[model samples]
Target: MTSPVAGAVAAPASRRPAVALLGAYAVSLVGSRLSMVALPLFVLLTTGSATRTGLVAMAETAPYALSTALAGPVTDRVGTRRVSIASDVASALVVGAIPLLHATGHLTFTALLVLCALAGTCRGPGDGAKYVMIPTVARAAGMPVERGIAFADGTSRAASVLGPLGAAALVGLVGAAGALTADAASFLVAAVVVAVGVPAAVAAIGPAELDADDPDAAGSYRARLASGARFVRRDGLLRSIVGMVSVTNLLDAAYGGVLLAVWATRQGGGAPLVGVVAATMSAGAVIGALTAAAVGHRLPRRATFGWGFFLVGAPRFVVLALDVPLPVVLVVLFVGGLGAGTLNPILGAVEVERIPEHLRARVLSLMGSLAFALIPFGGLVGGLLSDHLGVRTALLVCGAVYLVATTLPALRPEWRELDAGRRRAAEVPAPGSAPAPAGAR
Candidate 1:
């Protein structure tokens, strides 16, 4: 079925909203990636403590996870457009304040943590709001949800590549504070792009308005949240996805937030190497995502997911732990990125199909929350491991854990559901159309 918001706009079949949404997402994500590199370096350089670096990461993500979980119901009630714009504006202000405070000699660790938390809080809903709009935009563009999400993933991967390179340049030329200033500017631009580019009517229709006849549409906040939670708890595949992703995310956080930073510092390549490392991986991911956009729907979901996870996990960690040559490290990470790139399209399409249209925002948010639940502690765990066990050992341990968490779940029968939705969709005849011949895709 078409999304509730897809037909809200009566304009001719156009891809304008979809393009705009993707553009805004890409711009904002570029800014976020810049900060992702700069912020860790900033903390590591200033405090000279891996533990405190982890602490700062925790402070930011803790609020992010909480806000993401809580924002689902609010996003369902408030228009996605409004929340997205407001969140971007707020993020710009909070992120901009960090550099300003530092320039004024007033920035402290506590203040930095507080600002990061505020930025994270603003970011959570903004990200979720944008995610909720994807299916609507896809339908509007006359595209399959998987293809659209693959494009979205491609943009994100592109941003990941550019953001790091930019971060390295900005940090080298103007310091972390300056890179942060650029990040703030990107948010403002993203906010403005959404405000002008996407049709207000299309994005402004919330679930409550669209699902007016349903009693749950008018329910209170707690009731709405409970309903979303109940839906996730009962879905076997989703539950498995949530559990597996939670572990991987936590390990990823530790790797990104602490271990990677420490490694860069030790190598004396500093921010530039970090950027190179990140950019290469993202570059590979960009290619992978483009490939997925082209042919993902034709592939078997179960095998794609299983192999993708296998490729994306463990290798980079092992390479780094082995202290391989720079070229060798880059090659491994690039291959991993290829695997990572195929993932979101499959996951996004499945989740969008499974959740009822009316419950999209709430359900997606809960899933995101659960998936990211342990991420806050990832940095701390990484830091502790690095400090006590040494960086090499920590990397090896994390790689092993990642290998297990992502691979073992594929053995479960529920994971076979990954391809079922696609099969069902293929079998259903469109309105006014004859059924396909037997064995037709």
Candidate 2:
């Protein structure tokens, strides 16, 4: 007999619900994008210590890695939709406290760090839950998986532009504290949208344990998490993707969190300049995302994904190392953002294509956790390096590190497995289906 979750996944997909999901995602991202700029800026401005800024960044992201494990079980139990809404609500409360404490003069440096970490912990599962819902959303909307993921990625990039611009304007008018308050409000609003707007059939799937029809779905939380990890380990392409992303994310976090802010401050740009720099990159990302969403299906996944990494990774560091004028740096960031934008859509498509439906949440949680594991250390190290080695030397070294990391996937034999696996995936029928023809595409 078909399980209810299976029935839900098998429902006729529609564009309206998909649009609603995207809308919710976009709203949540607006807040996320604002915090990305405001929180780090807050630490840098208030503390005037690169190390302290790094500590704040570290505090926020460290829980993200650990919280993924916790998120998987909860998502599998409560359903992705409910989990997402609840997480957002919790995030709203946590993030809103920052401004409240600041106004009351009770917000200490340590308190800020703790609150940031609390928010990160809330975000990890919320993000994972939303990710898990994508496949179901695609199925319900009758949308192609690649198209759905591309839209998701594109929406995020677009928000990156708006969020920074809005945050910058808010900072000018009311300070970073005020921008953070706006961030909190965004989360609450996003929760309401997701809860009310998303279709019930697409929103919740109950506990995975009840889905006897799903081979990969049964098991205790630990076993389920381990199963996902094992699949990643055994799959060459997945393993390579996870490994490369882990290193690249670590390096990128440093640049995005500490390096960029410090560079702007030293260059005499201040907080608004920091927002401008971020917005420029995000604008490029929007273009890249739209292009990918339109034509990504025709592109060779390996070449486009790998080369995109090089453009995004190498240029930012090199330009910073050169100490070029701000305009020149902005141009490089724009180009790099274009390349960066193509990456997640490809990765999202590949992930959804490879993992079993039942294992989406668990595998995604593991993947996110593993990918972000080094991020905290990256920010901490970047800050210390900037302090000890100076920003120029740090950029050169980190840029070189990024160059090495991005280049590896192109040459690695395992990376080729991505295409090979795609072909194999195309040949196999989806769950509960008869086998495909011998040479199905």
Candidate 3:
């Protein structure tokens, strides 16, 4: 008999749901990138304080990390579809309120921070919910897992390129506050697209482990949360990835949130330069993602993961520290972006293949939370480093650290497992078929 997992994977393929999911992902990601540029510029322009800029960034990301860590069980229990929709709606309201309050001359820094926190809290689970839907939708579309994730990552990278450019243009044309209004509108559009276009079943797959009718199977929320954590703890490769990624994420957040902004401010390039630099890197990433989408499955995972990080990690930081001309920096970042592009598809494929379907949301959320746990402090650290050590020194220091964190782990035995998923896939018998005889090969 076909296993339920196999049966589900065998469901008649259609491209519609996949397209819808990617569409929603693209829209919301672009909005996020816009805010990423607009919000920092808004604070810097108004307050003229790097420390405060970091604080505001923290206000959003701290709650985001905490909420994402805790949201997995809730997402699994409430259903990914419902949680995703609700989160987007709440985020729109909270983000929209920022400009509205500012326009009314009633916006306090405290209020802005609070609004950012609310938006982050609302966004956390929604991101996890969407991530959980990827495998199902990929299978439904008959796309290979790695290819599907590559397409998704490519969509996101494309949005990154567009969003920064759009933010720069919007900020120039209408100021940061007006740009924020557009961000709010994008969230609403994403929610509508997901609701109308994605099939209901896409987000509702897997055994109903949390069903109320099966009280014994449906454990307490704490137990559910603990279960996911325990699995991650036991899995050596997952543990390694999470640990390495956490440090890298912290450094990346610092680069994006503080270092780049400060550089732009000091250089008198302001928001436009920041957008150009970011877009250049993202444009390169877009090309890299497309390349991965085409032949990633044929590549060696361990080497790709290692080299991709090596290329993406240290070069940008080194270039920025060098204070090279704009053209040189863009070229380095574009190359780095290419390396960065290949990473997620490999990581996503490994993660999906290794994780049990029933625990998808919780496990993925826990992993994401761990990876992002240090991000809240990233801005603050960047600010302090730039203030005390100078931007060039800080950039150099961060680059060295990133190099060590991302590359050293590849030497570990556990990293060999990065390629294990492909081997496993090759060995598995088709649904309803007997395994090949041991000597047949």
Give the best candidate by TM-score.
3
Model 3 C-alpha lDDT per residue in residues 134-240, reported as the tens digit of each score? 87777667677788899889998898778878998999999999999999998899899889878777655644534543332458989888888988999988899
Error (Å) of candidate 1 at residue 41 is 6.3
Give per-residue CA lDDT, model 1, range 1-441, as digits (tens): 343443244346458888899999999999998998898888887779888887787788889888999998888877788889999999999999998998898999999999999999999999999988887777666667788899999998898778877998999999988889999999999999899888866664545455773457767899989989998999998888899999999999899879998998988998789868877888889988989989998899899988888887899899999998999999999999999889999999899878876777889988998888888788889999999999999999999999999888889988988999887766754322455667764
Ranking according to TM-score, highest score first: 3, 1, 2
* Candidate 1 Cα outliers beyond 4 Å, as residue runs: 1-13, 37-57, 99-113, 171-178, 204-209, 212-214, 258-275, 320-326, 386-393, 427-441
Global lDDT for candidate 2? 0.80
TM-score of each prediction = 0.85, 0.82, 0.85
Residue 324, candidate 1: how far off, in angstroms?
5.3
Weakest ten-residue segment in model 2 by summed lDDT: 1-10
Clashing pairs in 2: 13-140, 13-141, 13-142, 14-140, 14-141
Candidate 2: tens digits of C-alpha lDDT, residues 247-288: 998898899879888888888888889878888888888888
Model 2: residues with Cα > 4 Å off, grouped in runs: 1-13, 36-58, 97-115, 171-179, 204-210, 213-218, 261-275, 323-328, 383-393, 425-441
Error of 3 at 433 (Å): 11
Report the poorest 10 consecutive residues by lDDT, candidate 1.
Answer: 1-10
Candidate 1 at residue 419, lDDT?
94
